[model samples]
Target: MTKNILISGASVAGPALAYWLHRYGFTPTVVERAPGLRGGGFAVDFRGDVHLRVLREMGILDEVRRRQTNMGNQVVVDADGGQLAKLPASFMSGDVEIERDELSRLLHERTRDHTEYLFGDSIASMTEDADGVRVCFEHGEPRTFDLVLGADGLHSNVRALAFGPESRFIRFLGYYVAGFEMPNFLGLDHTGLMYNVPGLGVNVGSAGGKTDGGFVFPSEELDYDRRDLDAQKQLVARRCAGAGWEVPRLLEAMWAAPEMYFDSISQVRMPSFQRGRVALVGDAGYGATLGGLGTGTAMVGAYVLAGELAVAHGDHRVAFPRYEERMRGYAEGCQKLAEGAGPFLAPPTRFKIWQRNQMYKALSWRRLAGVFDKMTTKAARNITLPDYRPAPRSAVPRESA
Candidate 1:
């Protein structure tokens, strides 16, 4: 039986789910608000063992490996912009460091032919019955589907429609973050430079494709609305007002830059990842930040969801429950790590920041590796996948060929 699957958001998790769903003989339609593929941003990585295995099974490891950013080491500077210390890139962005948007585009390209991508559209309402789900779109005509998945983001439309309001699930991590592209005026090479004002702020710029520099300002609590980009920009501008070392210049460029991304640096914690036929796969369900295992969890969640659905014969009740059960532990662990990173990235106090920096310098690579190994091993062990055999050759339809 062919099942019609409606996937919201076309970034990482949506396209990934579509890829596996298509391979499992289900038809997937992805709806994205972005008119086209979004390009450029900080690098994201696939750490640990299981996530790498997912990439390998998906047959895109080679492609992703080839396009990795490989940004090398970073040089940290003090408040006066004097060199403090340097660390390897692997520590920051993990083993594979590809530009975040690049990975999204590559994953989208892989499912382009197999999935129906509806750009510049969003779901307005979803009403589900025993038969199927009735979906009303912001642009397209109303339709029905066997199931709907929300990979939209932290403020997921599907989650808002299906679950309660976002405030119920989203936990503020007491920080605000913004990232945008700028000119390579710093004339940096593949190396990255970071200037830390200790607890006040931290600005990082790296020479890479499509990304010139990024500014990260830690805040106690943010008041600006997330949907208002203009206000968000003003918030960032106000926070860094009269700052030193090319900050004013960067702000000027930021005012003109077409693409600006901002968020509250929070995590989405849910008692359950799914309710009824509505399921959330990625950031919508659990997101802490780039530092958290959210990316890895999303990749692994996509794999498990699709695999479970395939094994359960498209029964969301069985598949969705199993998917959540397999991923909840890993998601919680990632969220915890991301929470720690917020303080570690920019400690709350100057004394604490100095102590953390000293610790980072003192820690040996072997010790760091041991800590990472424990994290990865624990996360990887949370899942137990079924050996679902492939369908018989005779079951393959000629149209699918």
Candidate 2:
């Protein structure tokens, strides 16, 4: 039986998978490259019945709700700082929304006691045989596990080792994004302000004296060192040069910001998520970096994978195919929602930006509220999940729920 499972990356998917695997009587080890849990990312929301069901099954729904960001509407503004249109909370925040870091911390807490976590280390290499998968770590000694999963996200190290180089799978969506946190000079509360020019957009959401900041700009895939902080700030500064309505102030804050996140808006597509006894979950298999229901999808994907393993009695040949069959279509639907995000955030021309603002302005009409709500939420409700009920006395559930 594949009782010992190794999961790479300690973010949402890894800890979450560990939680279910332990409940199903499988021992799970998680290895993360970060020294500890990361904090301060843009907000992530859970929408629809499927997302709520998974969160409820994990028994963390109440806690997640308690920590919700409660983010309000986003106001579009002109260069002179005049409000143009308002984007509703329903479109921005789902039924429940929380900061990404808050969700990560909560998931980690739930699984830390029973799951083995190897922080400050990462998978260096892997080799599979008929019995199990042998794994080596960058900082720790090599070991073998019954199965291995690449929960490690978009540019997954595990995917590199097992699948192929990243170029084959990663598709840049004609835009680059940068997010950071800074002092809330605007003194905003629960709301945010957005200002846009042709090919560029800046959004700042604040609560009290802190802000969650973001910039989306149209660009061809540009070459840059992913690890360089100052260079990233400079690139953003250059793209947004001579901009108006708090742009200079945000740029100043970006330079002084302690933590910054920058990336090309991209998606990962794969033919299959499983190869041999090794598999993938969350962003490693299917992901859109932003605007997609990525956070919710990852959590649900983790639950499905772990539950299927239990159902198949750790026989990967039986479990892996079932996992892919259930998730592929659902995953593709979510990806479709993300394809337009870049253009929506930063339109290619002045007329397009104005047209977008006007279109959303019409969405605010009371009569159209229902239509707006359904548009934002429908793609996320594309699947029906099996009710996986793990029994306390059984090592693996004898019958699937």
Q: Pick the candidate with the highest TM-score.
A: 2
TM-score of each candidate structure, all chains considered together? 0.91, 0.96
RMSD of each: 4.1, 2.2
How many angstroms is residue 121 displaced in model 2 relative to the true structure, after the best TM-score fit? 1.0
Candidate 1 lDDT tens digits, 150-172: 99988899999999899898988
TM-score of 2: 0.96
TM-score, cand. 1 vs. native: 0.91
Misplaced by over 4 Å in model 2 are 208-210, 391-401
Residue 338 CA displacement from its true place in model 2, Å:
0.3
Provide the global lDDT of candidate 2 against the true structure: 0.87
lDDT of 2 by residue, 155-273 (tens): 89888899999999998899999889888888889998989989998999975345788899988788888768889889999999988889999999888887788888999999889
